[model samples]
Target chain A: MMTLDQDSIHKHSFNITNLEEIPGKKIKHHYGLVSGSVVRSRNIFADWAAGFKSIIGGELPMYTRLLNTTRNEAIQRMIAQAEFMGANAVTNIRFSTSDVAQGAAEIYVYGTAVFVE
Target chain B: MNGLVTAYLQNHELVVGSALLIVGYIVGTLFQRNHLRSIQEREAFFFKLPAVTMKLKSFVPESHWDQIESARMVVGSVVITPDYFRYFLSGIFDVLGGKVKSYESIVDRARREAILRMKESAPMADIIVNTRLQLDTMQPSIPNMPIRPLAVYAYGTAIRLKKSSFPQSSEEAIRFPDQDIIL
Candidate 1:
């Protein structure tokens, strides 16, 4: 078991999967659910670019990049929470995104933290 | 004089509207065609990688379970905005309250692209299982705008099968030093 403090750096590379079980491993302990979320506002410049792009119609790469970054950060935070609980793996991970306001969106990720071997 | 001014304004509006329609049609068609072609090419490239919406055990045999190396979550996301032309067509369809073929194509392309991106993320994985897709629409509260960005997110667990022989004992099994419990 890890005894590291909350502010300490994570020493282990935690595994994350969206499946019920982690392949090639056995779950030794379960620590219940851990989740993380973030709400981000759209950048003004990107919004303007998106407006122009919509006129021509196609993929909005700027918004895509922004959302991807937001989601990855949310997942990282979830992993951090799992690490804080001394868990080395998280299973059955799920993600969701919702628009909270006019230009802001929130991304939430959650999973079951577990110790595996 | 007032009548002449009104007539000129009407003609100007007509010219601008027609010009925008023409531009939107040509550019949107070209963009969609090119995107479709690229999507087809990438799909062919990733034809060997199997991504299923079922559990790995349900499909793979138990005999090969020992050969599994690792599994990790993979995700692919895309945000697409419909071109002016498609949006216009969909608006007309909405008035008719029927099938919006134009919007359907947008969702189809976004879903496929998201899946393709997910596969591209784990090129070396043996297979991806329990795949799921989430779709959302972002309509920024910009006043008087018909723009709605459709976001498609696809995620799954990519499992890699080992190539070497399986370990015979606990001592012989591969161990992750960082994951081991310290007494």
Candidate 2:
């Protein structure tokens, strides 16, 4: 029968001796991973709707653009964190949302970190 | 005098009635055009799904995250291109003319965002098993138009396994050539 260990990556180890010295070795590697999320206040997103109603009229285009930009920024931040850890890969990635207030929304990013070797 | 007065009044009424009718027609046509435009835009936005999916996948691992063994749930989201709003309006025009095909940029943006988020949350694990894709629309408030954002997430139970239980092909293990002792 298949055991839990059979399904785990822990069972494997990579040999990095042949490869050039990676920068991460000098710095203390974080035992766990890091993550980033971009969140917006509901009121903030609502401004787009109000803007559409009064100015452009029908379908707020500005807000969509804003959110897109924010999300990208958040993602970039997360990647930077992983790179700093000297990790080539990450696992168990997940996202979550929370209502910060009546007019606010929060986006959350979470993941796991591992050392390849 | 009575007959002449009646005729004058009839003529005035006819002119006013005709004018109102013409105005009504113009207003009706304008409203119809606006409605049509909105519908076209909606269609364009929805049609962009495939490209968005493809673009988002590029940033995320095409295969499952290999580090996790089991998972209960997974969820993620990414904002489309910054110009996603422009496209929403342009898509409306495109739907009518059949010319709305620039979804690659948006898709790429989404993929990158999702992967970045994934990286942030799950940096140390070797693999993230059993990933799923989720799409959503973000509208901050009733006053704001909803922006379509997509996310790719891979979730599984994170575990530590000894070298014997893991798969270590030369190609996959080459990244860590220094840790040859365990092998």
Which number leads on TM-score? 1
lDDT of 1 by residue, B29-66 (tens): 88988989999988897777789999988866666777
All candidates' lDDT scores? 0.79, 0.39
Tally clashing residue pairs in candidate 2.
47
- Tell how far residue B50 is off in model 2, in angstroms: 6.9
Residue B179 CA error for candidate 1 (Å)? Answer: 27
Candidate 2 residue lDDT tens string, B120-182: 233233333334445444434553434333333322322222322335453324533333212
Which DockQ value does candidate 1 get?
0.36
Best by DockQ: 1
Instruction: Report the C-alpha lDDT of model 1 over A13-36, residue by residue, as the tens digit.
Output: 678888888766789999999998
DockQ of each: 0.36, 0.07
Error of 1 at A17 (Å): 0.4
Candidate 2, residue B103: Cα displacement in angstroms equals 24
